[model samples]
Target: MNESAPQADMAEQLAASSFNTASRAIVIGGSMAGLLAAKVLSGHYEEVVIIERDEFQERPANRPGVPQDHHPHRLQDLGKGILEALFPGWREDLLAQGAYEREGKEMHLISPLAALQFPYEKDEGCSRPLLEWVIRRRVAAEPRIQVLQGHVAVSLLTKKAGSKLAVSGVEVRKQRSGGSRDLEAALVVDASGRYTRLPEWLEELGFGKPVAEILHTRLAYSTRYYRIPDSLKDRYSTVLIEGDPSLAEGSGVFSPIEGGVAETTIYGAGGHYPPVDPERYERAAAKLIHPMLAEIIAQLEPVGNPRGFRVSECRLNQYGEMPEWPSGLLAIGDSVCNFDPIYGQGISVAAAEAMEMGKALRKAAKENGPIREHELQRRFGRIILPAWWTIVVADLRWPGVTYEGSLSGRGIRFCQEYLDIVRRQALQGGDMELFGLLMGVQGLDAPPSSLFGEEAVRMVVSRSKQDAWLEKQLEAGETLGDFLERSFPVFHPASHSEANR
Candidate 1:
């Protein structure tokens, strides 16, 4: 059973019942971030217009505008909560539209130390198209908001306000009509993604370009769709093999999607590429840390040819650092900070930023004052700092990812060593809490600070010793039990205190 977007004019209802201090707002992207932003802006502005370049279909499908739509996407529990907050009942609405539910101990995670099955936690996974389609439809239901498709934004119309420049409107050219128009707006938001033309738009208006930090990992991935085999249909919903660069050069993922189809993605970084050819793509899964994915996919029938995608780098634009950053102009989503995509943090981070924007707008809503442009952009910029730091820290471990002066030498070493321990400890038995915390942080549910608690620090310190001993055993061709016996001969599994550090 699929849930449909509400046809009721809730936007009209809000316009009639409440007073609005702002006249119009324009969101420059129809992406997940833009849709969520419009949902928030609708409450404060009398009319919110979302400009998009693609003509959307009535059904769920991919568009040429979003190049990464072919990949498997997820709304981890943390992001799901944010979506539910913005659009009450979003989970239910999404589930009704053929999205699969992921819960319990359904993941088969492989690492360098040992094969691990994650403790059960609820989540949702779907194709990127379906997620975008549902969100777009919901954005259309608001009478105060309008989705303008087949129009490309050409330039930002700016005005010199005394000593400062402010964004006044946007100049857009219609793709269908070949006509151009100016859309005047008090607030202009750019969520146009990684390929955004904000750099050109800003420079033409005589503003300094924001500094950006980019790390090139050279990650390439090939994804193919499949029909789930009846044998594994009822057993588990996902199997992910985390790429262990030490043992293997690539990773593999097999998860259920809508329409009873499964999507398998094989990826590699550091100049490695998974095959896009059907025969070789199937063979690509065999190089994972485990052969479970290869065996599973062998029994299923693939629905389409494997398609290849690349994420050459992770970029974070420094907009707030500019003293002369224009007022009435702000950007969110990938346009501000785009991750490597393997972490699956992009969608969740966008949702979190939308919430921040809403929080900033509430001040204007209360005072009946015009929306504060510079303050809102700066606030949103500060809000994403924590996640931005977390992303930089993680990608530093990969080869060819240049972050030379950004992170201190000593700090980088400590994070690398600590994360190595976290991965090793996650593979050990009776350490579900340690693994869960790591997953939560990766899922954007828990803050990176959560991993630095007294208990966690103690655990890492203790595991550091264990990891050193385990390394020796591997060099000497000894087993995990051998290392345990040689190191902790007096203690067994019952000695939880030793493992707890």
Candidate 2:
């Protein structure tokens, strides 16, 4: 029997409590966002159930829903800290399972002019499945949380009382046995990722879908894994070969994983992407920035054929501006907004969203009796918009990438000059303080406006001029190989011809 709605008086009493002791939270989809949502809901609700469409994985492994799990994934330092704050010792658990920490250390950053090899610091690098598994384990272990695997949520069950449209539960379909059932809850969270059908469901309920702002970049990621040498095992954690706009091609990054294995992924926007063919992949990667990456690829034995993913669209649902939202429902993570994966901001932003959602839920539980579903969704949307703009605006600079918004006269000039300064700073490498600031905003730690300060502008301008001059000299003189051989003793200390001397 389906659970009936709490009476008005009973709901009022439940609202006065410190937490929603009499209510339940039903989380749709059981990926990272779903699991994190479960954790947050578990603290406030009497029961938290996660409904997953895929079969249960008793061990740490991949699921059918997350196809990008096979590709390379990097968890930014911001995400690591956020995850730790949410679930303490989470990093330690991942590291124990052979996850690599590649930030600040073992990272080879190559610009058009120089190659920066920094020692590893603290960060998280693992397969998406492994990372998800760690979080899932923690969430699943919670006594108040339940994982209902092989249960596909077909539709949200709602109860209309006068003007209030509140979700009471969900109707689910069993994958294997073809059984159907209805699970009732006080609230529902949609963390069902980019391919979510929530909008259609809302439309079916006579609610106009939220306006979507789509920046269709036709972006694609091609990934392949290889066995690294023991000597190079400790050499560099990640090698980033940035793309040049002049070439109109792409960039490649090779991240070292556990057990002497490394994953290299090439990303291209539009149809100008790296080939899946092994030889062609090497050639295209060599042209990007670092020839050494291609050399490494040539030397290593490939683990398997390269897997490809096309992200043709990035959409931001403007739910914050909605006039009316249903009660007892919210959308978090990729279901709300999807960013370009090349920037590597997806996981970081998703984690930030989860943190925001948790804070909002806690605050609402304390003050309000029964939190209206729209309020939580709006707050979460408000927090994510600035970060979305930051990513979309910056990424729109690449040729062939599309943008829906407008930037008038001064705005256009300012943006052009701004990127020029950023490029220069990125190459010269002295603006760690500024980079830290920009990265913080990029990672959603700070507001987007924080980057537009006068001090930042000045620093970028002065550094950009210096970098530009250096670039001119390098371009006029020789390739990175010849220049390094002639000037730097460390990189090309002994040349081929001079070695005999």
Best-matching candidate per TM-score:
1
Superposition error at 15 for model 2 (Å) = 24
Please provide TM-scores, in order, for all candidate models, with all chains considered together: 0.85, 0.83
Candidate 1 residues 340-445, lDDT tens each?
7777767777787777677667866788775666665665555555556566666666565556224445445555567777866665654677877887866766
Model 1 worst lDDT run, 10 consecutive residues: 492-501
Please list the residue runs of candidate 1 whose C-alpha ends up more than 4 Å from where it truly belongs after superposition. 1-22, 229-231, 246-248, 368-372, 453-459, 462-501
Q: Where does candidate 2 clash, by residue pair?
A: 15-369, 105-119, 105-120, 105-121, 106-119, 106-120, 106-237
Predict model 2's lDDT versus the native: 0.69
Local accuracy of candidate 2 as per-residue lDDT tens digits, 1-501? 001222222223322435552377888988887887788778888778777777656566767899788787766555666778778999888889887766566677776756666666677667788888888878867888766666678898899857778777787776665656666778888988999988888888878788887777777888889988876666657788876643565778888765567889988875566688877777777777668778888888889888888888888887766777788788888888887777666666667667666666677768876565676676566555555655566556557777664323234334445655675576566667766676665665554444544445445656666446434435465653454334321212111111111
At residue 345, candidate 1 shows an lDDT of 69
The segments of candidate 2 whose C-alpha lies over 4 angstroms from its true place after superposition are: 1-22, 101-104, 405-413, 462-501
